[model samples]
Target: MIRQPFKARTPEELISLLSAVAMAILAAIIVMVLYYGREIIIPIALAVLLSFVLAPLVRLVQRLRIPRSLAVVSVVVIAFAFIFAMGSLLATQLAQLAGDLPRYQSTISEKIQSFRETTAGRGTLERASSMLKDLSKELDKPKEAANSLGTIAAPKAASPKPVPVEVLQPDPGALESLQTLISPLLHPLATTGIIVIFVIFILLQREDLRNRLIRLAGSDDLQRTTAALDDAASRLSRLFLIQLLLNGSFGIIIGMGLWLIGVPSAILWGILAAVLRFVPYIGAVIAAAFPLALAVAVDPTWTMLLWTIALFVVVEPVVGHVLEPMVYGHSTGLSPVAVVASATFWTALWGPIGLVLATPLTVCLVVLGRHVERLEFLDVMFGDRPALSPPEIFYQRMLAGDPTEASAKAEEFLKERSLGSYYDEVALRGLQLAQADAERGALAPDRLTKIRDAVQEFANNISEQDERPSPKVNPTTDVEATSAIEGVAEDAPYESLRVLRKEDLPSEWQGDHPVLCLAGRNPIDEAAAIMLAQLTDAHGLSSRVEAAGALSTANIFRLETAGVAIACLVYMDASSPAHMRYSVRRLRRKLPKATIILGCWMKDIDPAALESLREGAKADLAAATLGGALKLCIEATGVDSLGTGAEGQISKITAAS
Candidate 1:
């Protein structure tokens, strides 16, 4: 066997390979900087977040006729003072907690014994222990038997016993002792100092920093850069502020709950929880561990521990699910997976501090991606919004031959839109994409067949839905006044044909199948015709669908045209007007007196081209959407047949035309 050497078939392939390699290299470099330079970056990140939290306060103080420098100083001083007070209180509580642990030793021992007694019976643990004992006895029997049988070895000369030795240095003087005591604190003090300095400068020179960022990002697109910055700042500020308040509230509630439950050092646990909750996902669990362990040690019975567990289980969910969503609205805009992945990545690089800052940092990246075209992949990966639009998703699902998911998507869309609009906006557009791909020869025959089958199945699944189009008031129209009317407002956009009832259809259209929907030449054309027939049936006009082959010169005369009042030739790809004209002529010959309407379901079709096609086909009317076709059919029935209620609507449709 021989392997062929790799070669680029086109410049595009080579460029793509090079671009991917460059991106990988860039990512590796970024990771290295994040890991090695975290000490510097961490402080800056903290300072930036702190600045966001305090910006509103600084502005508020400045608004009260104070100097900007004074306002900033005042806000920063006040904020740090509160944080310092909390820190001192936490330290005191922690010291007390440590001092009290020895008192609970007896209770802890009793609980452990009780737990062991309860689980000592024939379970997995007990069986494993018994087996280990038997194995140990079996091994020892060999040594004992050898000794009993007097299987002795020759004695060797006695070895000398080694003496123990110890080495000690002189005791340190006071200066050395003081240096030793303070050495461990130096790093933390230095880090704190850096953070404070950064925060002060960031707040004082906020505008300067923003301008520098904009310049670094790009001065050419100032508007976009400014918008991105504003979006990021506002989002981060709102997130930080709300998180602070919610976490603080959570702590206060936990403290009160623990106090009521008689847990030791409740206040300490509460403050610890509030601080740790800033870290994502597992923070609450870590915070709960301290109090739960204390509960176990402090109480003889399991009541305290159970109560503490219950407190966390109940409170965390309520705050996380109910309160947080209500307060944050759309949240930090990072996807759940992005949040977890970022937490792991940043923690690996910078430890606990990175974990706490992960969400805020990822938000910045997502915002940047949203604004910068080159970095848009970041937003698509990390942002909470769906990456693909409805039409693209539908097309993808169709190609994958998953009609179930495609139908699900359609059902969701139909919740807010009428079936006609959904077909026009999503299904038809998806088929258009498939048609385009097929025309370009990019799709394999099998893939095209799968798409066609999936689309047919999806259309069939949703055909039973009620077709009375949902009345949608135009944005410019007064919704209140429109709602006050008995039926759909005349000024509202006509989504589909409206009939008072099935009985209200004209005598000519009263038969079991009054509308004939004929597919055009394309493979997907039958799917479009099916959609039109479904919509037509929904509006009280009974409809039947026929495949493109039914319109052939040989098969045309055999199509059932009896009692058919309207005939619509449906085309997914309407690029060739001559083919559409030929199909229209065949349908006209079959149903000579029937109203012939050309249904060209092309998105954004040029008006002149459509009119020319209609004229060339000699179609009574042409529609560029499923909704328009249904409307044209309804109009052909005449306003008198639909009763007085539909007169105004038909008149408006005519005036618009």
Candidate 2:
């Protein structure tokens, strides 16, 4: 037997595949360009980040009637001046610290000597030393014999230096000496000059540059381009400003803490800390290293080193975890993994400079993903937003046969939503999925059983998990709630639905006012029926769920005698009204006086088909959601109040009447 080659049958599928391949190639090309062009790119990126930081200052200066160019120049000059001064101060402190290193040499020597003495006996060091000494003595015996033998062997004529040879050396010129001094500074000076020039020009022409970028990225769609650029600018500017303030605060705290701990050059350490922290992840460690090393060198004991370590360990976490979340919220829109991965990737591409620019660059990518259809994958992969909605997640859990997680997800949703809403949004949607799978012949028998059992268990425990009272609905002229149930099953289902046993009517569900919830063909539909019954019971209407088998021709007489005031026929996965119309008509005929409700439980229903269903089935009521159907059931029973103690009141009214 030969196997036929697989092929994409649809044009859309083929196009999608090609697009994915193209995106992969594009991403590779981008990584390569960023790596190779880093020399120029790094400075430009630095300048861009700096512009975000200094734009507000430039605006402030301009507000004072200063020309834009002059404002840009003034801010740049002041910033560079402060930076150079700080560098010079740090150099001076470093030189002094270096000079003081000699004083700690004695302390270091004493500690080394103590360690040696402490490990001298009965240890790996002692054994290693003993072995080395023995080996040396054995080697020295042969060397001594060789020396003795050489001395006995001889006399020879002395060699003499026959002639003097001239060797000329050229002296260094003044220019050459100057060149040597300046060559080390040349590249750095040139780069700094370029950065300053870029910063000044960017600040002066900020709006023009923004407009140019919009044209370059989205010339055909000006509105989208403008929105994307504005969003990116707003987010980047806010992130940079907040980070600067937070880092500055961190540095100030370190300085004060060090001062209280009696460490030298606390101010210098603080300044270094603030600047270095622009680099994420490892920045805090790098900033702490200098202060820790200085503490070790300046103090005669280890107390200062320990205290300095403790300070950073405490401060970094507090700022990173608590302060950042409280202030930034979801403004950055980056996942923690995305943050670290971007840092590593940028660091690899542009070295330390890339690390410094990673967050801003990643933010730009997220914004692009938000606006560009093709690049939406980046947002799904890296942005902090949830990839799957609650209904999708619940349905996926059910498909995977993880009842525990499905129930847990239901409970989580219940925290913010009502149990009825949960039924409509999560439980019913999951059943729709199962029904779809059963239709496609994709769901396994056992897996279907698991999904059914899980959903039923969740419905059964709604009251136990949520202690809140059920919502009140009026008995007459049932008001339709406007809460939209928004989920559709886009994927095929994987399993069959669970079957539910017909629940016995409660004692109070007697006389002429009991509610009957009719389960459809599948067990998943029965789960929905269970929820409706639960709601009816909560609404002061006594209710019971009955399987379809219990209401067949043979049992129609039994149901008629049961004194059920309302019959709610639940169809969670209604493919069409044609198949259900006969069953509904039969139920309607069997209970002529009872109010019949045909509930097509889904996110959406066709209005024409729904009207047809109502006409064909002769259902007195029709609903598209569990909540709607349950509301109709409660209304049909003529229960006015859903108060917690209404059962007792209802019993007393019945007795009085």
Candidate 3:
């Protein structure tokens, strides 16, 4: 019998099917986000998330047998205290900076006017806002008339649009005065409330929350959900805590620099350095530019301005690249492309608060994916490096290292099915060349270094270019940067952030420059300050626990003195060629730091690492409570006897009571 003619899917049907799936998913996500946009939304989301990050901490504390309530309180308290102290420090600086607003403004205005006069195309003693306003309205008469008629029925609300942009200015005492008077009242109360409420709620209902989760999910679902929550919370707590520590380092370095330079609000600048660090590429530039502008406004010498720039060159990368990525690695698993896209998407959708929540939200997505399976697609999309078996990886590593055996073993280790056309060609070419060279005895150590270095240079070129804005697109799908991702770079001169520049510079900066000092509620500055101090002290560790329980704060060279103090931050990256050379070039500045002695040991950390650590800490603290986790970090880093046995106490209580 003849078979009936078969019909295939038409192009339209295929398109329609795909389109409907996409739209349905989009609509559902938007509806969910909107439905729970406020109130329990942040908490519920944070609870599920923070739990995963803090799971490790909870496990640690459970080992101590301390009451869960007490453990959480301990973690919360430590986190809050660190944050509060930082806030206060930044507030003091911001107040100081604002207090000097008049001076800062006057100087900036003068500089603007001078530039405007010098360049015919630039400006004419006019503020940017006023200039833009005039230009916008110059040809808008007809449009204005039309707009007004359209709105004639009533009127649009005239509230000031919130814009966080504020120009840098010189201030003699405005910030100090404001801090002395106003901040003491407002800052403490608001900060205190956030701390108290967050801590109490997390501690009190934690068990109930866990039980509710268990009830909502069936056995398998319950186990998976609990595991997911525990993992995310523990990791997140550690990440957040690490972030705080890193940021604090940045603030210290920056503040010291400003202070030594006789800049009025060193503390403020330091804090700015720390908080701005959260914004990635953009933040570092802003932080660097601010202090440089201040230095230029006050100092008559071009040398000092150059010094400021030079210092930034070092500071930005040291904290941004070297320090951050160290402990964190690519652990967040988010690709650079995914990170920037998510940040931009969330910022557009929910503003600054959303920007702060973007990474955490992404983390939540990854965790959720582990449970639902469907969402795991996102985890793969966002991750920097694909996960593989360790033993298989080690075998591949050995194979590649041999060069002679690399060709035949390519698919044997990498997998035949997984290779894309592009990847297949590239791998074959590379391995073939290596194998041939091995046969010819061209695999000398020198040649290996040369090829490796060339690869690195090519990669660095890629990374620098990757910073450009991406093509605009809907936020529904993954947006990745490159197929071959680069390793994190080296950190620069956070030490100079703590350096004293006035003494290092000509007499003009000391006497003739108009010092503009102001302050505001920016936490990044505090971190910069801490970092600056750490750099100068010769020993790079910042945590009290790391420094044998003594708060090591000496010589953390502020900006003024950092040029001479800090030598370099070194690192190693095997994942990408761009990682090594770019980092070395960025951190070392071609001129090496003088070795004062033979006994000094220095280690470099990637700045990305700090944020990861902070996120981990915060998530852990929120989910599992903090006592055990904090103790673990302290003990891990070898902090003085804060009493490690407490973990056992906490764990015993969980089981017995």
lDDT of candidate 3 over 107-163, digit per residue (tens):
667776676778655545356757889988878988988888989867777999798
- How would you encode candidate 1's per-residue C-alpha lDDT over 232-262 as one tens digit per residue? 7777777788888999999999999999999
Model 3's TM-score against the true structure = 0.44
TM-score of every model versus the real structure: 0.88, 0.79, 0.44
Global local distance difference test of model 2: 0.71
User: Which structure among the candidates has the greatest lDDT?
Assistant: 1
Which lDDT values do the candidates have, in the order given?
0.78, 0.71, 0.45
Model 3 regions lying over 4 Å from their true place:
1-65, 113-199, 203-233, 370-372, 386-657
lDDT of candidate 2 over 152-203, digit per residue (tens)? 8976558896898899978879999999999999998888888998998888
Q: How much RMSD separates candidate 1 from the native structure? A: 5.5
In angstroms, give how far residue 15 of model 2 lies from its true place.
3.4
Where is model 2 more than 4 Å wrong at Cα?
A: 1-14, 112-169, 215-225, 279-282, 321-326, 426-450, 457-466, 469-527, 530-565, 589-594, 606-612, 644-657
lDDT for 547 in candidate 1 is 80
Q: How many clashing pairs does model 1 include?
A: 0
Lowest-lDDT window of 10 residues in candidate 3?
648-657
